[model samples]
Target: MSDMLSIEQREQAWVFTLNRPEKMNALAPELVLALTEGIQAAHQQKIPLMIFKGNGKNFCAGFDFSDLDTASEGDLLQRIIQIEIMLDLLATSPSMTIALCHGRNFGAGVDIIAACKHRIAAAGTSFRFPGIKFGLILGTRRFQNIVGTQNALEILSSTRTFDAQEAQKIAFMQEIREPEQWPSLIEQAEQNNAILSDVTRRNLYKVLYCSAESDQNLAALVRSASAPGLKDRIRAYLKPN
Candidate 1:
């Protein structure tokens, strides 16, 4: 289990890194479960700073669809929605999550970063919303809040890749750095994470946004995601371009 994700905790900081460099550190069910448990551990340990990144060149390549078999499309979608809900608990934890993003961010990868309080990307990294091609929905509302409605629409709609410079221009990422400079840049990011007092900022989230309703609706829709022909469509879309 530790092989899937590595967690390091200190008095003030908790770092969770995706450990599978192969397959670009893709998210498997076990990895997602470990990440949820790690977030819980951070709360119990009173850690207020959280950093999410990858062990190698990529952040996360989204859900490991290869793990799915003949499960009902509904069952698979329910699992995906469950993963989303559980992952959100990390952001709502009594910590400030800052993503040090490099390489490619696709599908749920993008959603994870959007849910973070702050993000810094390496200049060489790229961002994309592949959900459009797959006929899936992503963090539209959260992304819109970060990068604005127009850009968010364009990003989600186009499914095209964008470099870090374009990402910063749209305010999707804060700072862009060369890979060599990420260590010092992340250290500085830790300083920013320290500003939040020892308390949950979830209230701030709910005050500015009422996402529960949308979440419920999304969960319901996603739970029933076993629409006829869904699997066929997914199989077709997943074929390498």
Candidate 2:
């Protein structure tokens, strides 16, 4: 729809590219909405696979703070809800999803990859979950599902940056690709999807993402992130240290 995202349908796959190169493909609300719409349409069309990638040097830098800086608490909560809904759709959609991440993947960017069934990162790509710095609990459960409880705690608590190798070692990233190898790997994925039947695709998704226990952490996150003093904490975190 908007230039914020580019949606294309190939023979076997629907590809959604985040197009905000100037902003490092940041997740502005409109960009999020465009992506969500693309994913929804793919599901409706029964597309076998959907690919999420960024057009810039970086995959994503996370949520655009420009809008949040002036948002009221009520407005902020609504935005968070919208993000949660979009991510949930991505995570649980019947269509298989892949995330191709490169460069800086921070905050909500990391969460986006974690939601995908398949995650491939470029060499030298770095990821960080800086929500602790903002006094928010975004994607805690999904990160836990990717890397488990102990790893998630250590990674989130330290608020330290990690590279693609470390992410793979933790099983957070399923594959790491060199710059030259991306095209072949993506082509292979497309070829593989070409032969997969809808029944098999649905079964694969169910086996992979739906087998997990019903997650209560999302609800807990909503309460924790919306509690009193969050705005104050965010202000403090954003201030020059």
Candidate 3:
């Protein structure tokens, strides 16, 4: 509903496009809430597939730090928690999900891509998960599940920027695709979805996805983020010498 996120029913899928291109589609509070609501609606409507893509140069820049200076630590923590909730919804959704990423993505942006069933990126797209650098454990379990514990630890500890090729190599990204080829990918996904009834597909997802960790993930995030001086830690990470 918010201008920050555009939701459209395209063929058999609900396309949720990040609409704030100027800010690299960062997940501001409003944008996060909008995304959460959209996913909820998609679940309720039994949409067969959901696609997440950005409108501009990048998919998402991660958690918006534009308002950090004016925002209190409590406000920042709440925002982070909201993002985690949205990610959990995407991760557990019965509908097939795809994240079409491009440009540079960071922090929670990469987390969003990790949540989806299909993670695709443009050739030059890159990603970084800097939450650990700020002493926040957001999306750690999910990342490990996608890329394995050792790979996740190596990447997170170093806070390194990895290109799309490397992401696909480690299975962080399911495929590296050019923007022009995304339509075909979507078509293929639709075809795959059509093979099963909605109830059958939902049951399949239930058995395949281990959502038992959702509560633990949320708790870990809260504990890390609730530690004293969250804002200070973020500020230092943002302006490292």
Each model's lDDT comes to 0.74, 0.83, 0.93
lDDT tens string, model 2, 1-241? Answer: 8899998898778878899999999888899888888888888888888888899798888877776568888877777777777888888888778898999888888888988889999899999988788677877888898898999999999999999999999998898886578667768998877686889879877887873533464676578678887677777866887
lDDT of 1 by residue, 129-153 (tens): 7765656664666778889888888
For candidate 1, the 10 contiguous residues with the lowest summed lDDT are 217-226
Winner on lDDT (1 vs 3): 3
Error of 1 at 162 (Å): 1.4
Cα lDDT, model 3, residue 36: 96
Name the top lDDT candidate: 3
Off by over 4 Å in 1: 68-71, 200-217, 220-224
Kindly report which residue pairs in candidate 1 clash with one another: 74-226
- Residue 172 lDDT, candidate 3, scale 0-100: 90
Model 1, residue 181: what's the lDDT?
A: 82
TM-score of predicted model 3? 0.97
